[model samples]
Target chain A: MFELILTLVLLVIGFVFGQIAEKRHFRSIIQREAETRDLLCFNERRIPQDMFSPHVTLVCGSVVVSVDFFKHFVATLRNLVGGRVSAYESLLERARREAVLRMKAQALAQGATSVWNVRVETSSIHQGQRQGIGAVEVMAYGTALVPR
Target chain B: MIVTNIEYIPGKKITQHLGMVSGNTVRAKHVGRDLMAGLKNIVGGELKGYTELLTESREEAVRRMVAQAEAIGANAVLNVRFSTSSVAAGAAELFAYGTAVVAE
Candidate 1:
């Protein structure tokens, strides 16, 4: 009985704090994305022919995020039904956006006007023995074109 | 060395193609970080330790790739790409590859 009560209390705490953190992260991502709008980023395998850049370098950004216990619990329940797990979707979205933002920031810092062949890779880390997911990592990388 | 994910570098000419070069590294999180990440999961936030680990692993892979390119006397690496996979329960491998070239 005590264990059950403790689990419920943790779930409530996770729900409340997790929601707040997710909201804050989303706001920050939106704001930064707007700020870096002018930096051209693409997945094309070729640099624009018209581009007059003489120097190119690699740039990357990475982020690791984990779902709260409440969402993890909910996702496990959803898994029983064997359908889409929406609870983890938002977690992935946040991590991807954040990683891209950081990569853009790096390019901008290096005086790069554009990034090409951008790619994002994701992986799951720190899975508990019994729990489903402990954390997810998103890595964004690209070549930055800086004009001479 | 000049490194770009694109097949061709604008305004530069490739004098020779040195073939493919690659670097890879596998890393695992420490127990302390694993514990910390577990707690962070309860609250739902960024896991700084894992982020740092991935970053370090990427840098190491890139460095090794560049070393290989230099060994072939290549001045640039083109069409660079990276990949990651879980090799173990608590470890991941980061791999980077590109075509080394001599350019001017």
Candidate 2:
């Protein structure tokens, strides 16, 4: 009974705190995405020679995020039904977006007008002691072309 | 060395191709980081420790790949790619590959 109560309490606390953090992260991502609108990013292998810049360099950004206890708990419950695990969906989405934003920021810092051949790679760094996932890592990389 | 994911550099010419070069590293999570990550699972956010580990592993892999390219007397590495795989429960392997080339 005591262990049950502790688990419940932790779940409630995790839910409250996790919700706040997720909302804050989403807000920041949206704001930054808007600010980086002008930094062109693409997956094309080639950039038009006419618009090409002689100075080219590599840029990369990485983010590692984990799911809160409550979400993980809910996800486990959903797994019993064997359907989509929406809890993890948002976690990965945020990580991917954040990684891209950071890459764009790096390119901008290097005075690059655009990034080409952008690639995003994701991996699970930690699997939870429990059945759920513990942490995920997203890495975004690209070649930046700095104008003369 | 010049490393780009693109097959061809914008203005530079590829004078010679030195074939494919690769570097890989397998890294395991330390006990302290595993403990911290366990705690973070409660009210989670970013996992800084894991991020650092990945960054370091990637840099190491890239460095080794560049070393191989240099050994081949290549000035550039083009079409670079990275791959990651789980080697163990708490460990992962990061592999980088690219074609070494001479750009003039």
Candidate 3:
């Protein structure tokens, strides 16, 4: 009975707090994305031929996002069903967007109007007996074009 | 040395292609950081500790890559790429690679 109560309590805490944090983070991401829309990003390997003036540099952004207890639990159950894990989908989406936003911020700070050849790398971090994802690291990098 | 992911640096010509160079490092966060991350996982948020670990590892990898480039008489490294993998239970491997070239 005690174990059940404790698990229930943890679930409640995880659900309530996790939802609040996700909402808040999403709001912040949306606002920052709008603010940084002026900086363009492209994955094309070739630099624009018409682009003149030649100041360029490299920029990168990285972030680590952890899953809440409730989401992890849900994902584990999802594994049994062999289908899409919605819990992890949102988590990855958030991490990827956050990483790109950070990269754009760096480029803008360097007086760059756009970034070219953007690349993203993701890796899962495990801790303590590989008990479900401890966290995920997402890194975005690119070459920023600056006009002098 | 100039490092960029693009094949060529803007306003510069590649006088020589020195070939590919790479650097890799495996790193793990301290116990304290792992503890904090565990706590944060309950509530779901950004893990600053892990982020710092990745940043540090990436810098080290890049530094090694640069040293290798310099040894090859290259002034720039272009088309640089980064990769990350979990090589052990607690350690993450950060790898960087690019072509070294002489630019003028």
Candidate 4:
């Protein structure tokens, strides 16, 4: 009975705090993305003949996001049903957008006008004793072209 | 040395291709970070410690890759790629690879 109560308490705490954090993070991401729209980004390797810049450097951004206890529980139930685990989807979406935003921030710091050949990689990292909780790491990288 | 993920650097010609070069590293954070991460798991937020770890490991991997390219007399590495995998319970491995090339 004690274990069950503790679990329920943890779930309630997770649900409340996770929702608040997610909402705040999404608001920030959307605002920053709009501000960063001028920084051109492309996954294509080719650059137009007139678009070449003299200085090139590699830039990267990475983020690690963990799932809340309540979402983790929901995902566990989802696994048993063999269907889409929506709880985790929002987690990954937030992570990817944050990673990209960080990458853009880095590029802007370097005085780069554009990023080319952008790539994103995501991995599931183990969190030691708490294997029940899911943590994902997302990394965004590209070459930033700085005009002379 | 010039490094870019694209297959070729714009406005430059590749004089030679020195095959493939790669570097890899496995890293684990201290117990304190793990404890903090566990606590952060409840509220569901960014793990800044893990992000720093990944950045450091990636820089190390890229440094080793650049060293390999230099040893092979390549002035640049093109088509660079990065990958990560959890090699252990608390350790992650970062790998970087690219084609070593001489460009003019």
TM-score of chain A of each: 0.95, 0.94, 0.94, 0.95
| Runs with alpha carbons beyond 4 Å of true place in candidate 3 | none
**Candidate 3 residue lDDT tens string, A1-148:** 9999887888888899989999999999999999999999999888877884467788899999999989988998999989999998999999999999999999999999989999998878774455544688999999999988
TM-score of each: 0.94, 0.93, 0.95, 0.95
Please give the TM-score that candidate 4 achieves against the real structure: 0.95
Q: Supply DockQ values for each candidate.
A: 0.71, 0.64, 0.71, 0.71
Off by over 4 Å in 4: A127-133
Which ranking of candidates, highest TM-score first? 4, 3, 1, 2
Candidate 3 C-alpha lDDT tens digits along B1-104 = 89899988877889999999999999987777777888888888899888888889998999999999999899999999999988776578999999999999
lDDT of 1 by residue, A1-148 (tens): 9999989998998999999999999999999999999999998867766886888889999998988999989998998888888889999999999999999999999999999889998877744446534788898999898987
Model 4 DockQ (Cα-based)? 0.71
Candidate 2, DockQ to 2 decimals?
Answer: 0.64
* Candidate 2 per-residue lDDT over residues A1-148, each given as its tens digit: 9999999988987799888989999999999999999999999988996987658888888888988999989998998999899989999999999999989998999999999999999988645344534788899998999999
- In model 2, how large is the Cα lDDT of residue B18? 93
Instruction: Give per-residue CA lDDT, model 1, range B1-104, as digits (tens).
Output: 99888788788899899899999999998888777777887889998887888899999999999999999899999988888877776687999999999999
lDDT of 4: 0.91
Candidate 2 clash pair list:
none
